[model samples]
Target chain A: MYAAIDIGGTKIAAGLVDSGGELLARHEHPTPAEEPVTAVEALLGRLMADPRWERVRAVGIGSAGPIDAAKGTISPVNIPAWRDFPLVARVAEATDRPVTLAGDGVAMAAGEHWRGAARGRENALCMVVSTGVGGGLILGGRLRPGPSGNAGHIGHMCVELDGPPCPCGSRGCLEVVASGTAIAARVGSTSAIEVAEAARAGDAAALASFDLSAKALAAAIAGTAALVDIETAVIGGGVSKAGDLLFGPLREHLKEYARLSFTRDVTVQTAALGGDAGLIGAAALVGHAEV
Target chain B: MYAAIDIGGTKIAAGLVDSGGELLARHEHPTPAEEPVTAVEALLGRLMADPRWERVRAVGIGSAGPIDAAKGTISPVNIPAWRDFPLVARVAEATDRPVTLAGDGVAMAAGEHWRGAARGRENALCMVVSTGVGGGLILGGRLRPGPSGNAGHIGHMCVELDGPPCPCGSRGCLEVVASGTAIAARVGSTSAIEVAEAARAGDAAALASFDLSAKALAAAIAGTAALVDIETAVIGGGVSKAGDLLFGPLREHLKEYARLSFTRDVTVQTAALGGDAGLIGAAALVGHAEV
Candidate 1:
């Protein structure tokens, strides 16, 4: 058995997983962003005290980056307090178990590849289009974590060289165009759900906003297909919840812009694991890690 | 021994390669884009007449899209006469050897991964920034040909959503901003060399053009690093000959925009193989195909 932790800016989730990638027990808590170390320690302590924790042999963590997977450290952009935090060592010290780490998007991709929409697919991209656009890759049947565990930061890839400037200091990144934050920002709202509802109600402004976002996403997908030659893209996150309102337009735009025959064949679909992907993928690390 | 053929719009290069991926002998001729089949046949005849052909066991071909690698058919966008042409069968008939085919860019990546600049690197992207931008990928130590073998068409990725219309029917693709064609077009010239020379001579317009191209390319590289998590990018082709004029500004832009630590770690370097990359990469196909 293994323990998987999905650490986000707002919430921290923990799960007990079996060798077959099954979830035996799960729990969640609001993240204490102000006290980063204490928050993580408390979360781990609470989870470790649970009856399910007795069976856990290892721990896997997925966090927002920039991360040093090799060193098990995290320096999340949103979590300013987590500058070079020793995530893996702290978790291991608290739990007395082996630990592994990866970016949140990478963990999501692992979950999808292991048992979700991208199963059996050797080359695929798993993306989370939420508050921010994050990505993870399964290329040539292996997980690509990059040199610093920052692989799959697709949101930051410049989609429009002259478009809006991203918080990362780049212009026209996919995140700035297609992320839930971008969507909300476009409609002058605070949540993606509002934008989705507005678009569904035939709000021209909302619809236009989504159309632009979808086009940007499709363009990025087409480009990504060309770059990595992946066959499928499994999309997850809040923005993906818009369903056809997002995917239909995204596909239409992809067909228009996908110039290469091979790239045109790429399929973009919703993720199958939903929110559980991060935890499941983190657990999957115990079984598959080199990728 | 293996026979490798690089079928370009303007040239046909054939090489005899040993098991160690060395070129034993090489031949080159101008390609008859107007009569691709005849040109290919003529090249095959020349290759077969060589004594090295007697020892060659298989033939590998790399051509421009859209090719059906599984069916060994070619329909290059630039070679109007190659629509649905049975290139593999023709080559097989000519050489009396088994034949395999892939996109020229894919083959280039395979070649680089097998014995060139990308050797020992598990995940790398090899790009040719010549007349038009092209790319090939080695992901997780495997060559990615994608579904239709037209993967690695990085030049077409939209870097500017409203920058310029590409021949591929897309607006603001990376190729429109950073490719040799795009650079030359921006300068009202016909070749990247002229643009490079102008930039070298402190032509303000040319320097600005290169800077813009570098910025676009840097954004794309940061994006690619975000998606695939590769550590190194080995760049080749005529445009790369500009050396520091291109790379200096690219690195500067990347550092400024690549806020993610992992993405910031990505190294962009010149390809080590130089002009021989295509032929050597073609020869590297033998080992790649077997794998």
Candidate 2:
């Protein structure tokens, strides 16, 4: 048995996983943003209280970056209190088990590659379209986390050289155009779901916003396909639930920009694991490391 | 002994390499644009005439894309006659040796990582600034050529949403701004060397053109650093000879656009191997397979 944890800016989710990719137990709690230590303590309390924790031999934690995977440290910009936090050590101390660390996106890719949408694919990219856009890569059947565990941070890849100024100080990053936050900002809505629903109802303003976002995403993906030569992209997260409202324009833009024959053949699909990908991917590390 | 060959749009270069990365013998010939088979055959004839060919154990060929590395076929856009050409088989038939194929940029990265500028680095990006811009990646001490051996085609990444349209049909690609071709076009010059000389001589037009190119290149690199978290980028090829004319502004732009603390620390440097990288990298693959 293995324990997998997905640490997000808003919440902490833990799950007990078996060898065959089944979830035996699951729990969630609000993440403590006040302090990194306090948050870990709260998570540890929850894990220890669970009966399944006693049988798990290893633990995997996935969080937002920029992270130092080698040192198991994280300094996520979204969660300021985690600066230089020894996340792996803290979790290990609390759980009394071997621990592995990775960025949330990388974990998601691993999960998808092992049992989700990318199960049979050799080269693929998995992206999360939640509050923010995040990405992970599986190239040549290996997970690429880069030197500082930022290899799959596709949200920051500049898509619109002149579109809009992003929080990262770059202009027109994918995150600025295609993410949930970007959708909300563009439609003057409080959440991405609101924009999705509005577009579904044939609202011109909302549909245009979705179209623009999807086009930007498609352009970025086409460029990425040129760079990495990957044939498939697996998209997940809350915003991906918008479905055809986003995919139609995305396909059209991809065809418009893709010049290389190999890149033109690339396919984009929605992720199959949904929200459970993070948990399953974290658990997959126990077996993947041995390979 | 190893044989490395760089097949470019304008020229073909062959070098005999030793285990220590020294070029024991070298040869060059203008690439024939009349027909694909004839051009390849002519190059092969010259390469076979070299004394080093007798002792060479393996062959490596680097060419323009879009290539099918697994199938050993090439279909470079500039070489219109080479559509779906079986490059590896023909080369192997002529030389009676095993051949490995990679993109020009990937070969350059391998050469640099093995014995040049990136010798000690485990993760780095090698960029070639020539008639066209191209890139290659080294991650976790291994060459990453992606599924079709086209992993580091960074030049095509969109850097400006409103920038000029690229031959690839994308707008604002890095190649459309930072390549020697782009620089020449901007200055109405015949070649990159002329633009570089004019910039060195304090020509306002030339300097401005380079400045714009450098800023775009730097912004793109900053975005890549945020995604891949690499430590250094080793630059090579003809345009890189401009030195500070390109790098100084590139560094400034990187700092301006870099929002994450980790990305701000990425170092950009010149490639150590001047011209023999292609052949050396090809030879490096004598005992290796795609990774």
True contacts kept of 2: 0.66
Candidate 2 CAPRI assessment class: medium
What DockQ score does model 1 reach against the true complex? 0.67
**Candidate 1 structure quality by residue, lDDT tens digits, A179-285:** 88888888899888998999999999899889988998888888888787778888999889899999989999888777676677789999998878889988876
DockQ top scorer: 1
RMSD of 1: 2.4
Computed on alpha carbons, the lDDT of every model, listed in order, comes to 0.82, 0.80
Could you give candidate 2's per-residue lDDT for residues A169-270 as a string of tens digits? 777788898898888898799998898888888899898888877877887787777777787988898988888888888888778776666688888999
- TM-scores (chain A) of the candidates: 0.95, 0.94
My TM-score estimates for the predictions, one after another, are 0.93, 0.95
Between which residue pairs do clashes occur in model 1?
Answer: A143-A291
* Model 2 Cα lDDT, one tens digit per residue, B1-291: 777777777777777788778888777777777765666667667767887668878887878876778899888878877888898998899889888888888888888888889888877888998888888888778777776766788888777655788888777788998899989999899887899899899999999988888887787777777666678889998988999999988888777766665677888999988877777766655533534
Q: lDDT of model 2 at residue A209?
A: 86
